[model samples]
Target: MQEVPVQRQHVGGSVCLLRLLGGDGHRTVRGFLGGSLLMNCKYWHGDEMKPTFWCKLGTDSDCAADIVITSKNQSMVWRERFSIRDNHAGKLFMVTTEGLAEGDMGTYLCKVQRSTTQREESYGVKVMVSTNTSAAMR
Candidate 1:
């Protein structure tokens, strides 16, 4: 995979803007085991009408196994332990994963599906699950 430049701007709390030049970039996120994690991914303004998806990166480097998919008509979509919300006005999307486990430590993808002729725009995210010793004690 080719490396792309990334610009991060804090957007309050756990939210941030991940700006990528060619609409693709890599980022790292951490979450406590048995807790949750939130990831925000930015996209071009005009692309907001398109569908957005979140999934663990598969061997083919595509969203072959989608965790959650948000429709243009619906601002949010939830499935099992995963939820995705699209903020069309903000030109960004937020994905939340709850009840994290050790197996969740891997690469994920934030993708936008475009016209059939166009390739999907995506942002790569690496998730790391850390154990909370204090919580484990209790």
Candidate 2:
């Protein structure tokens, strides 16, 4: 019998090959004023349930600021404009934004806590918001 090796890439001192598993990588998502957008993150097939958090990347720090939501203890709080939803059967989380505004334009991250001290994160999702109507463009 022959053995096949799985390919891997090191990302922030962690191995992340989820991009090859039908998951999104670093990319930009565009939305228009008064529109909506969805960002997605997937879990490995057998990953133990852990806290999932969505946050906006900070301008001046390695840490993420503007935490959008989290799935710790199966509890969550959402602002009127942002929310996070978990799909257990699909092993993923969807971060949604409604009534988009210019302030919503930025980078976001989806992270999963593997353990008390370990976490895995998806590539950044940059959000771009534009005026949806010609009158608004002026």
For each candidate, what TM-score against the reference?
Answer: 0.77, 0.67
Model 2, position 112, has a per-residue lDDT of: 68
Off by over 4 Å in 2: 1-25, 75-77, 132-138
**Model 2 CA lDDT for position 120:** 66
lDDT of 2 by residue, 1-138 (tens): 111122233322222111212344455556567766666566666542566667787866344564664655563447677777666677777676777789977877766667656546454666777774432222
Highest lDDT among the candidates is held by which one?
Answer: 1
lDDT tens digits, residues 1-138, model 1?
A: 343434332223222223332334567666556766777777777898999988888778766698898886887998988899998988878888878889988898888889999978888888777685333222
